[model samples]
Each structure stands twice: as C-alpha cells, then as structure tokens.
Target: MFSKLFKSQSALRRFYSTATQNLTEKQEPKTYYKITLLRSAIALPKRYKDTLVTLGIHRRMQTVFHPHKPDIAGKILRVKELVQVENVPASAVRTKTEQRWERRPDPGFEVVGTWKNKRWLLDEEGI
Candidate 1:
C-alpha cells in the first residue's frame, strides 16, 4: 500500500513539473516609445520646473504629451534650448528604474545521496 501511494505521489509531482515547464517556455513582447527633453531646465529658474510640472514632466527624464498642435509645437520649440521632445507611447511609460531584476539564491540545497535521502540531512532518520 505504501509503495502504491508513493508511486501515485511521484506521478502527480511529475505532471505538475511538466506543466510548469511548458508555461515558462512562452515569451511575451514588450513595447517602447520615443521621448525628448525640449527645455534645459537644469540651469534655469525654479519656475522652469513649474512649467514642466504643468506639462506633467517634473523629473529629468519624465515624458508628457501635448496635442500635436502648432501652438504646442511652437512652445516646445521656444524651449528647445532647455529640453528635448520626442514621441512617447502609453505602453512604454513606467516608474523610473523599473527594469531592474533582483538576484536570489537557489531555493534548493545541494544533495548527495541515494534517491530517498538528502545529504543535507543531519542523520539517517531524515531529520
């Protein structure tokens, strides 16, 4: 009875592992956008930051939008010496420095023994 129970448990574990592996094999595409800073507010008055704030761009690399109108273009051009402007899409917007990945230690410890016992165990009782 114990042998049969163990065999069934192993089969279920194998099925779960296979399903997880299949899911991990799929890849997804990512979208990007173009942006530029038209004004160089870095050396300008604090009011410049206010202007950028009004435009929804408060940070150095922040990107915002204005309708593609001549007036908007003119304003951008007027401040061109201070900032850069570019085409940015909604899909590309994310929190600053959000692309970083964290490194983690392996979840399993190294084992060296028979199929039933793990080397990390303190004693033959399986700890």
Candidate 2:
C-alpha cells in the first residue's frame, strides 16, 4: 500500500538524519596536540624545565592538549626526550574539572535539600 511505503520512507529519512548528526559530532577540529610527559626533567638543564613549564605539563605522566602550531612543535622537539607527543582530535581534550568529574564515583544516595529550605537556617544564624 502507498501508506506503508510512505511510512518506511519517513523512517529512512529519520535514520539518515540521526546518522548525519552522529557523524558531525564525531568530526574533529583541524589539528591538535596530545602531549604526555614520559620522564621528569628534574636535575636536567634549566632550559628543559622551562620548556616543560611552557608546555603546561607540571609533572611526569601528566597529559595536556594544545593546538598544533610551529612554536609548539619546536618546543616539543626541544624536549622530545622528556615527552611523548601525538596528534589528537579536539573532542579528546578535557579540562581539569571534567577529568575530576569523570573520576568521581557516584554515591548511592541523593542530596535532598533545596535553597529555599536552607534559607531559614542561614537567616537564623545571621549569615
């Protein structure tokens, strides 16, 4: 029947739209750097320590994301012996807070309080 055919076509359209949306979300920005400190620069030359600091890596095993650029590439090359570098997609980068949130374990219990209810406590304490 024409109605059945029309329904299938509509479903196909919805499927195609969803697929395209997922593809777009997966698409990454032009270029990015995934820099991980493999070795510490302790006791090394001051230049090495300065380079690591410039790259935003504060310690060994720390990973930082940066945009791919000639200056950054030059800096990486300067301390290649102290780090492992790779190209990564933008979505792979995460902020410190996001990393903490990801590592946090969910509590089985829920917080059952509202600002309105707590307002009285604050008022009584003159806070």
TM-score per prediction, in order, is 0.34, 0.62
The segments of candidate 2 whose C-alpha lies over 4 angstroms from its true place after superposition are 1-26, 112-127
Each model's lDDT comes to: 0.58, 0.88
Candidate 1: where is the Cα deviation over 4 Å?
Answer: 1-35, 38-40, 87-127
TM-score for candidate 2, please give it: 0.62
For model 2, residues 1-127, the per-residue Cα lDDT tens digits are 9999999999999999999988986776547889999999999989999999999999888888889999999999999999998887788787767877888998887755567789657767889
lDDT of 1 by residue, 1-127 (tens): 9999999999999999998877754332222223356445877777765666655565665555555566566556656666666554444454444422223446597655655655545466657
Largest lDDT belongs to which candidate? 2
lDDT of 1 at 76: 63
Best by TM-score: 2
